[model samples]
Target: MASPDLIEQRQYAEAVLGGLNIRPFRVDLTDGLLFVPKSRIAVVRKLCKHFDWPFKVTALTSSS
Candidate 1:
């Protein structure tokens, strides 16, 4: 599936990613984006919601 064709949608996404100085990456499902900034994680989460995409945060324990 793909997002609808709309300029505003693109601009909003670009602004969000730009503000966080980060990028949205999707190389594969199992091998997801790595090392996204903690500060930018929230924005990523919100964008994922707005776009109806799944954004998952894997919690790590010190033992790992």
Candidate 2:
């Protein structure tokens, strides 16, 4: 279920995240990063796993 194309990846991500109520504060398409709420990290991780998407988590100095 790996997303081979960027457009499809974005669409899939949007749909999955929306359904899970994990709204991203920012989306950096150039780097393909979604800055979602810190509290929802676990959900995001689960979504990535379920979709066979490779993801990494990075803590940022921001409020959730």
Q: Top lDDT: which candidate number?
A: 2
lDDT of 1 at 9: 48
lDDT of 1 by residue, 1-64 (tens): 3234433444555566677667442212333322245555666776667775433533222332
lDDT of 2 by residue, 1-64 (tens): 3335765766778787787677654545566566677788777767767887544543333652
Q: Give the C-alpha lDDT of model 2.
A: 0.63
Candidate 2, residue 41: the lDDT equals 72
- Please give the CA lDDT of all the candidate structures: 0.48, 0.63
lDDT computed for candidate 1: 0.48
